[model samples]
Target: MNELSDNEALMMESLARGIAVRAMKDHGAVPPTVLIGNENTVIEYASEALADAAAKDRLAQIARLLATANDATVVTTILESWARIAKVPGGPMTERIEAVMIMTEHRLGSRALLLKIERTEHGKFRRLTPVSVPGLDSVQGRFTGLIPPRSPSPEEIKQARTVLGLLGLSPDGKTIRHDLN
Candidate 1:
């Protein structure tokens, strides 16, 4: 497998975000979606099942399956998901936010894109108001941690070290970061 280019990763991000935002605006929600892009094609995956208690798990499973199947050569994958995020710092405030997690197995790098969303309120008689927040519904965004905590496996560590190396950091060293919420 060859290393994936930054352009490929950015393209995946753009495609996934567009799909997620369109879904959010049309349905007031984002269905868990995955877009796998390679040299000349893009494949999308999404479950048709209803969102239940296991929806998050189901989304992860879908993503893992796709990743495993195409592990050798897929350029990048953007896992678009609807998830809860801390609304405030260390105080238990949380809100549902939009997320897109990206990874590439060619060189095994990963990133997460989290977005806060705000919607316009309905006016009298459920009519739309003129105060609708402009494009993309008033979003604020930043990258987050390594997608949350669970001890990463040996393979995961190796991949991460490669990412660190890309940043000119010690390949076997790790650093702590406090993500912006």
Candidate 2:
């Protein structure tokens, strides 16, 4: 796989995040999801395999599948996960932080984005903050060809904003508050 343009990488990341947010809204939790694309995207929900596979095994299976499928140049997997992270910049690590993990293997290599989130006492997920990790990019696509992508639809943006509202975020965050008050 060749490196992606800066714009292409950003677009892929945004789309993957939107898909995860929407899944959270639908399932009340992030289920393992896989999206494959060449010129079109096909979404596969891995909920059935969740019972049979551990997180590590599941990811490996996805990698193997992608590698064998010659046409699949991009693959993204999203799931609910726990992350151990520092509560302060250089302070004690939090034992467990609920998170959304999105891993993508694409034209420009790979990235796994972990967005830290919290479930309020009332059981609503709040906040979507990016966290840095050293080795999360372990899922590089071994694609021999780059998959050309179709243009993003306008509706995709609207749908993402809706998911953000569902997750209690504002667009710029002031005028579009997600609070019910």
Candidate 3:
């Protein structure tokens, strides 16, 4: 598949918002203007009631409270209160609630990349850093031993020959030749 373009990304964002709205409607959630924003773009879900000064003020207060919270637990607590105030019902609201819970959960390790720095003994010049590849965790059992062996069928061999031809491989499979003058 091809990579997603900017327009496709926007369309996907719209689809997600539509699904959220539908879920909210199904669960009888009070309709609040849903807003999705990034550093560059801001998309608003229009609602007549959300235009009120009191509602806007409350939203601002909630936003301020969230901004003050540095820890995940505090942030989750603030989000939960905000969701309650917004009158979010079951389905999509449940998803939002779970998201908040995940945000608050303890992470197993740091997501940031680690860097190692080295300095010369003479202190004349220093190199920036080097990175080591992380090792893969070991799996529990040997599942391959339990599985059955299989051989290529006639159709598979035919398809393989077609692919080889496309790659300019000889039909007899004797040698590989490169185009040259």
Per-candidate local distance difference test: 0.45, 0.56, 0.28
Task: Give the runs in model 1 whose Cα sits over 4 Å from its true position.
Answer: 1-4, 49-58, 68-106, 123-181
Shift in Å, residue 137, candidate 1: 24
| Clashing residue pairs in candidate 3 (N, C-alpha, C atoms within 3 angstroms) | none
Record all residue pairs in model 1 with backbone atoms less than 3 Å apart, i.e. clashing. Answer: none
**What TM-score goes with each of the models?**
0.48, 0.59, 0.20
Error of 2 at 17 (Å): 1.4
Per-residue lDDT for 27-146 in model 1, tens only?
A: 765555555444556667655544565765544544443333333233333344556544555545356554444433233345444454555565111111111112322222221121
Candidate 1 whole-model C-alpha lDDT, 0 to 1: 0.45
Instruction: Identify the runs in model 3 with alpha carbons over 4 angstroms from their true place.
Output: 1-19, 28-30, 33-51, 71-181
lDDT of 2 by residue, 109-150 (tens): 666788877556988766567777656666454221223343
Please name the candidate that would achieve the greatest lDDT relative to the true structure.
2
- After superposition, which runs of candidate 2 have C-alpha atoms over 4 Å from their true positions? 1-6, 52-59, 88-92, 134-181
Question: Which stretch of 10 consecutive residues in model 3 shows the poorest summed lDDT?
Answer: 72-81
TM-score, candidate number 3? 0.20
Question: Compared with the true structure, what per-residue lDDT tens digits does model 3 show for residues 59-161?
Answer: 4333222222211111111011122111232223232111110011111211111122223575422332223223211111211011112233556446655
For candidate 1, the TM-score is 0.48
Distance from true location, Cα of 103 in model 2, Å: 1.1
In the order shown, the candidates' Cα RMSDs to the true structure are 14.8, 13.6, 26.4
